[model samples]
Structures are given as structure tokens and as C-alpha cells.
Target: MTDEDRYELLGEIGRGAGGVIYRARDRDLGRDVAFKLLRREGSTLDARVRFVAEAQIPAQLEHPNIIPIHDVGRTRDGSLFYVMKLVQGQTLKEHLNGRTSRSELLFAMLQVARGIAFAHHRGVIHRDLKPSNVMIGLFGEVLILDWGLARPTRGLSTARDEHGGTMTLDGDVLGSLGYMAPEQARGEVHRQGPPTDVHAFGGVLYELLTGRPPRHSRTLGELIPRLNELPEPAPGPLGALASRCLAPEPGARPQSGEELLALLERVT
Candidate 1:
């Protein structure tokens, strides 16, 4: 059978600026999978380059906590698509809707840190690290999702689009505001590194403890100055770690996810 007939699209499970994810059945494997298809309308060459990177990057990261890409191809109409394991669970953002135990939340966050640590070790930096980008599976599995904004620390920083134009320029602002690091907020892409993701992990931890993001501003202008102005977290080891992770200066925070994971392991 042709690539078009190999998977039958069932329904859309998620949609983003670059692509749409559908619940599809792999005819050959007879299993349900997530089929992420690059959107056609308004899909610029840069967006297409990023979409391909999003799939290719994670496909190389073979970790239990990172979603696995089974196959990637284009439809008969020429829209790019990739198949991945269909997770049966809510996003960490949705899971946080109910009052979760502090221990349970920390455990989940620890798992996220582990996954991120592995990615960092592999030289991949997940520029966007937020609760919504995390998945909590039905059996207590935590998987990191969305590698579109991820950059490599050890390789060429920029990607080439179809027209040979640079896909991601240094000054292009990316990532969510509330969880974004100071350098990231300033669009200083050159300064983003493991510490960037560490800063976001701290934001995630702060939200878990307080049910709110570290920053409350509605605009980048209002948020940039106040990025360092986080209220006191609850008193304890975890709280102390959160404060350190959210430190305004990158040097003040954990250098990498591995360091953050080590620190978190000490919290009782």
C-alpha cells in the first residue's frame, strides 16, 4: 500500500501554529498513533523547516520520557506528516486543574527534569519548557513534547529554509512569556543554553507549588522587568530550589537539567 493508505486519520487530537495532530490508525501495525501533519495554509518555508526539525530532533532522542516518532512522510497532497505513539493521558497543564498533592507534583516534575537532563546530555536544548508541553500518561508516565523550538548547543544554530533563508534568527523571540528566561525574553538567542531550560523548569516548579506562573504580566514589556520579581515560595527544600531556579542571573541558577535533577533528588 502507498504511504497515504498506510495510516487512516481518525480525528484531530491537537493543533498548533505549525501543524495539526490527529489520532490515526496505522493499517500495517493495527495500532493507534498520533499523526502530526504540517498545515498547508499560511505555512511559510521557515515554518516547514521548523516542523521537519521538530520531527527529526525527537526521532533521534531515544528516551522513555520523550515521545517516539515511528515514521515520517508526506501525504498524496504533499503535506508532511509523522506518526508517533498516541499517549492516553492529560497534559501536565490539564492534570494540574485539580488539587494535586505536593509530593505527586514534585515527582512528576522530577521525571520531567530527568527527560530534559537526558536531552541536554545529548546536546539538545528544549528552548520551551512549560507544563503544557509535558504529558502525564495514564500509568504515571511523564513525556516531554514539542521540540520545534529546541536548538542544539554543539552544532549549527540556524536552519536553512527552502529558499536558503535562515529559519531561526538570533533576535527572534520564542517561548511562553511566563516561563521564559531573561535572555530569551530579550531575544538574545545566542545566550540561551541549558540554563535557559533550567530557568523554565523553575517556573514550572513554582506554578506547581503556588498554582500560578512566576510572572503575572500580560505583555512582554511588563514581564521582562518583573521576571526576577518572584514572590517567596513556600518554606522548604523544594521552595528553596524553586527560588534558585528562577534566579534572574543565569549563573545563579542550576547550570543544566542534570544539576537540577541532582538538586531535586535531595529534596525530601
Candidate 2:
């Protein structure tokens, strides 16, 4: 059936370079769905391609932590769009507006890490890992969102990603500046992989501890100098863990989600 025939557009809930997310309803199934419509005008070919990956990548991985995809198709206007389960809680960004107890923070982070690990097991590398893209459901389900920049690891490929010559992620700084790893910010796609994601996850952990992004210094000029400042010998265990993850060299950081989860569990 056609997109319009199946889902009714209720209203816009969010917007990003990938496209607009509408709070839609599946007429036949009688349930709410988040619909992302790829913009036709003002969208470059790469953006459209990433929009396809954003719709498809996450749909391939079936984990409780990864947002699930329900349907995908083109609209009557020939615009690409996809439907996914509607989350009912705030983003990790919104949820982190203020600090919570240490235990609560660690629990949420562990779940987030588990989700990342699950994706990694499926050969998916979430190049963009940040609080804004992570949704914490009302029932405490932590979901990783936005797979537009995600890439396949060695010996892995998805049906949607292989649809055309569109599998290669951009060599530009295709991730959120503040949360990106140094290599990612440098547009060195060749050096990007699991370590890149771990470093960014460390940045997230740092944010959780300090309530500020560790990579706040954006540009290389500012970031390089600030990295020299070091973390000032970490005030506590959590701080130390974050410090390890935020190390300038990706190799020095936790290499895998499992390793991170184990280390963070010890500190927690």
C-alpha cells in the first residue's frame, strides 16, 4: 500500500538534516509511528543516501536498545520515508538536564553501552553516538537512534546499504562536532571503526560525570590545546573512567563496548 494510504500524518515531532519526523498513525494497525520523510528540495544526493541508510541500518539490528523500524517506502511526492516505533520519553540530552543519583546514571549508561555492543555484534558501527540521539523510554528502555552515519564493519553489509553505490560514508566531519572522535572530526574515514565509537561513548560518559561535553573545544586548534590540559587527575572513580575513555589516542580508550561495560561496572 502507499505511504499516504497506510499512515496519517499527525504533526511534526522532530527535524534533522536527514529529514522531518512526523508523529503519524498506521491506519491498518491502529498505532502511532514516527515517520521520517526525506526532504526533496535543498537535499543533496549524499543526504538522500544517508537518509536511506538512516532508515535501513537500524532496521537490520533487532535489539531492545536499538530503535526498531516498522515500514519503509516513498511518499506520493516521491520523497523517501520510514516508520519506526514511537518512543515515549525524553532524549538522554533532555534527561541529563540535571544530575541524578550515581547509581541511576550508571544504570542508564550501562544500558546504552549494551545497546552499542549489540549493534557492534551485528557489525554496525554507530559513528554518531551522542545524548541527543539516545532516547530513554518511559519504562526505562534505552534506545540508540539515528543511524545515518553508521557504517558496516569488516565482512558486513546490509540489503538497503547495498542497493546502489551508496554504502560509503562521507569523508567529511559527518558526525556531531562535539561528540565526534578526533579522527572522525578530521574526516579520516579510514581510521574510523569501533574505537571511534568507543571514544565518542567516553565523551558521553564524561558528559554524564561533569555535566559538560569533554570535547567542548570543537575545532582542532582549540581541541588540541585543551587536550593538553588533561582532566586534572580525576576527582573520583567515575572521573577516572571517563578520563580513560577520553584519552587523545583512540587506542588508549576502551576498545569495545563490552570492555567499557565491564570497567564502568567495577567503578559503579
- TM-score winner: 1
Which lDDT tens digits does candidate 1 get at residues 1-268?
8886999999998897868999999999999999999966677777877877788778888899898989888888778888888999888898777766777777889899999999899888898899999998999888999988887776433343334645757325778888989988888877889999999999898888778888877788888778668667756778899999998889999999899999999994
State the TM-score for model 1.
0.93
lDDT of 2: 0.79
lDDT tens per residue, model 2, 1-268: 7667899999999996678999999999999999989867787766777777777788878888899999888877878888999998888888778555657666888888888888777777898899998988888888899988888775455544466655444534677766777777766777777778887887888887777787566555566455434454346888888788777777888887778878887887
Worst 10 residues of 2 by lDDT: 224-233
Give candidate 1 misplaced runs (Cα > 4 Å): 155-165
- TM-score against truth, every candidate: 0.93, 0.91
Error of model 1, residue 234, in angstroms: 3.0
